[model samples]
Target chain A: MEKVDCIIVGGGLAGLSAAYGLASEGLEVMVVERGDYSGAKNVTGGRLYLSPIRDIYPELWESAPFERPVTRELVTLMGDGASTTIELASDRFATAPHQSYTVLRARLDQWLADQVMEKGGMVITKNRVDEILMEGDKVIGIRAGGDDIGADVTIIAEGVLGLLSSKVGLREQPTARDHALGYKEILELPSSVIQDRWHLNEGEGAAHLFMGEVTKGMMGGGFLYTNKDSISLGIVVGMEAMRERTEKVESHTLLDAFKELPHIRPLVEGGTLVEYSAHAIPEGGIAKVPKLFGDGYLMVGDAAGLALNALLTVRGMDFAIASGFYAARAVADAKNRGDCSAAGLAQYEQSLRSSFVLKDLETAKEIPHIMENPRLFTHYPQAVSGLLEKLYTIGPHPSQKLSSTVIGGVRKDFMNARTLKELLAMRKI
Target chain B: MDIVVSVKTNLDLQMIRIKNREPVLEAIPYKTGDLDKNAVEAALQLRDAVGESKVIVLTVAESNRKVRETIKEVLAMGADEAVLIVDPALESTDQAGVARTLAAALQKIGSYDLVLFGEGSSDDYSGQVGPRVAELLGVPQIGYARQITAGGAGVLVERSMDEYIETLEAPLPAVLTVVSEINEPRIPSLMNIMKAGKKPTEEWSLADLGLDPAAVASSCETLSNLAEEQDRKHIMLEGGAAEQAAGLVNALLKEGIVGR
Candidate 1:
């Protein structure tokens, strides 16, 4: 039996980040990835918030492969035939030490894996870990491709699916009820064109989100992020919403439809499609977050249900990188104490709870449930766009007074108790 | 018998993106030439067959951290050791320059009963390095080897040619380039990969081989390299299926493509 000080499964941001920290501590670490390389199998939708993770492994982020620092934020409320867009171009967001930067997982993960290698970490790719080697309810190691290897601690960062972890009873099997399906197309556009379309300076990025009619009143929306020379345009739809629809809709059709919308068409016109990817995202929030650590094992990244969708911004990568950082520190601490039992490794959960990873998740805990109501995706966008369209339009007849129109529109849409109650209910979150 | 397998690592061609008809080569991961992996497998099998044998992997590429990282793929695949001949000068070196460098590295590595190479690198496919190295080393070279076996005082090799397969026996200390049909390369196990870092590796430069850099520089300059642009003649035939079928047949007959 071969053994290492640590075996990190799945060479993703989580696993690679852990390996980077552990190797810096002179610990023997190995990362087993199923893809040809670390980022080959990863999908992000698709920006990383740097502020949350700037302090942890700050040196690595300095030279990280960031596409562009997002400066402009746009959210469109799509109605039947009219859509209203709110654009926020803040000076602070565009300044030095930006908050978030768009990232391509394939480039980002591979670069992080390279850094891990530089730190004397072994990242093994193109091999799937078939089983988590267990001994009497304790995960001791992993068996991958007929290679049985042991380790003092096994960090299961196997990502969103977590098939092996679930098969071993470490986590619950993912259901359509607790997940979302994201489909993205990387459309190549010249840097000048991206800047012109999104109205940006050189190397500045924009994040455009569309709600309401985009997801067909479903509990999901459309997102577009500008990259260095490409724009990642994608749509996310709740899996349960998709499965429960009376009309069968192929996921790709939704993307094609989105590209054809009058507002979206010109934005993507003449753009060549480079890569199309679809992935399942964990949408369970903190409630579904599994036990972080237990005898000889710890689960980080999506495997532990650590993703959050705050409507304004979708976050998972930062939580993943941060969780991996904490996992490494906990494992190193446990190894130094010469005890890897559940009790010894319990610091992982406590540290994450204190870190921004869990705190942010806890702050947004009710978002997943609140977003489950389809009216937020449907009624709100329609009401807002409809009211604004009426206020701006001049019909064939005489128009009403601005004050009367405002009151009428408000009384029509905002007077209902259900709507008010919904609004007040959201204040807690 | 000590065996040496020479490999060339190229940017993963599949991941290369074409921009403005030119390849976007930045950030592409480097990979061993597909057929060169077959050569490594052949050497490994031969080493195991002949007791008290060892296999040493060799390459001549850019002397960078990425190249060193790329070489680990072969090292993890059961190779006993590796000798990397890398220098900044080899970046633009041509096939002939590569042959000169590998021949010199082979000489520096001393005794070997067999040396192996792929018929051509996966990237260039110039099919010149193996024969050139064999000529420079003054060893009998047999290429396109599909089967090789150690027998008596020599080895028997079955070579696939344009017309037929030829079987011949070559004495000890020969160079053979195996075709991809030789054997399947084994995926390195997790344990082997973990231990690959400990395997003794030697790095050298043209300076170490006592060769001048400019003497082996590329002789020819490439004027341009662009992806072939293909235009589709998207002709649409309007009508019912039967009419459209007839129109399609007529178009093909007019173009002499089919329906003659």
Candidate 2:
């Protein structure tokens, strides 16, 4: 039987990070990935907030494959035919250990896995782990293709689906209500065109988010992040809300509708579509965080529901990296004490709680519930656009007072005491 | 019995992007040709049928990191070992040059009862390498074998021809090319992928195979390889649903795309 000190299932950021940490510390580690390469199956919004990862590998920013630094942020609220946008660009976002950078996971994860291998870790791709090998309620190894490979401890970072995690009873099967389905397209354009379209300097990019009519009143929104020479555009909708939708709208139909919007069409005009991908995001927040440790096992990343959907910004990769970092530290401590039991692995939860991961999740735990409010998707955006139209439209006719016109439009559509109350409640989170 | 399977690393055509009416081939992902996977599967199946056999995978390409990665994929697919012939001089080699390099590699391997290849590669569907290699090696060649079976001291192949299928018998030490319909390629399990890393893979240059670069130089030169831009009529039919459907039918009839 082939044996290793640790076995990591899934080769995304979380699994690769743990493997790199353990291997760098002179531990035997192997990562088994199901994709042709590390990030072939990974999809994200997607941007990596570099602070958490920089804390783990300080020199990574110099050599890591990053698309562009996001120096501009834009958020748009779309009504039936109009949009109100807020754009922010600052030099403060471009400094060292910068805010965030857009990443193509297919490139970033592969480079990370290569880093793990360069550190003397083993990474096997294009192979799926069938089951977690267990001996009397403790994970001992992994079984794939009628062969058993032993390990002292196994870490499951199998993304949102968490197939192996659930099979090993470390997590519950995620339901549609707890997840959001996302579809993305990578559109190819010249770098100069992208720069001109988004008003970006040499190596700077923009991250844009859209809500309201983009989702057609569904509980989700759209995102567009500029890569080096391509634009990643997609829509993410709540699965429960999608299931409740009266119209049988396909996800691609939503994306196409979004592309046809006057505000979005020009940004992507003349760009050739290069790739389309779809994935599910864990949206249940901390409420859905699964059991973090078991006998001879631990869970991290989306497998443990570490994604945060704060409406304006959705973050998973950063939390994934942070959790992987802390999980490795806990596992290393357990190894030093010569104990690989559930009690020994309890330090992982403690570390996560003391770190920003669980703290941030706990603070914003109500954001997901607030995002489920239908008025945020339907009424408020239309009212805002209507108020803007009333204020801006001028003709030969007599004009009413601006305040009265705005109040009349808001009262007619969505702005009322009840909605104001809900908005205030959402802000408290 | 022993078998030599010829594989080619070609740009994934599905992932190719066009820019300025030209294929943007730089940094495009490379993989074993889609049909070449069927050839490898056929070789592995034959190895199993022969009771005891070794499958040797061979590829001739410009030596680079991508070629090495592509070789590991086939090795993981169950090839016992592999021979990679990479040289900068072979960068622009044509089908004839590829056939010569493969023939020389087969000669260097000393002995093999059979040779296998895909009917055509994805990048250049020239369908010439297998027959050319057979001619160079002076062996009987079978093309487009849809089904193969082992027999006493020989093999029976069901050849797929344009008009009709023909059954042909070839003795040991012959070459055969297979179509995608032959068999489904197996995805290597995790254990197989792990073991593939430990498998013996040897790198050989033209000099290692006792072949002079000048002798096997490519004769055919490519003049132009450009992306074909498709032109479409941007006609809009403005009316109600039924009227728009009628308008589309009329337009199709005017273009002779549909019969009345």
Which has the greatest lDDT?
1
Please report the TM-score between candidate 1 and the true structure.
0.97
What lDDT is obtained when candidate 2 is compared to the true structure? 0.86
Q: What tens digits encode model 2's per-residue C-alpha lDDT throughout A144-224?
A: 767788877899888899887687676798799999999899999889999999999888889999989999989999999
Model 2 TM-score (2 dp): 0.80
Candidate 2 residue A198 Cα shift, in angstroms, is 1.8
Cα deviation of A61, candidate 1, in Å: 1.5
| Clashes by residue pair, model 1 | none
Provide fnat values for all models in the order shown: 0.92, 0.33
Q: What docking class should model 1 receive?
A: high
**Candidate 1's residue-wise lDDT over A111-185, tens digit each?**
999899899999988889999988988999999887789999999999998899999899888999899999899
TM-score of chain B of 2: 0.90
Model 1 residue A173 lDDT score: 88
What is candidate 1's local distance difference test score? Answer: 0.91
Task: State the displacement of the C-alpha of residue A247, model 2, in Å, after optimal TM-score superposition.
Answer: 8.5
lDDT for each candidate structure: 0.91, 0.86
- Kindly report the docking quality category of candidate 2: acceptable
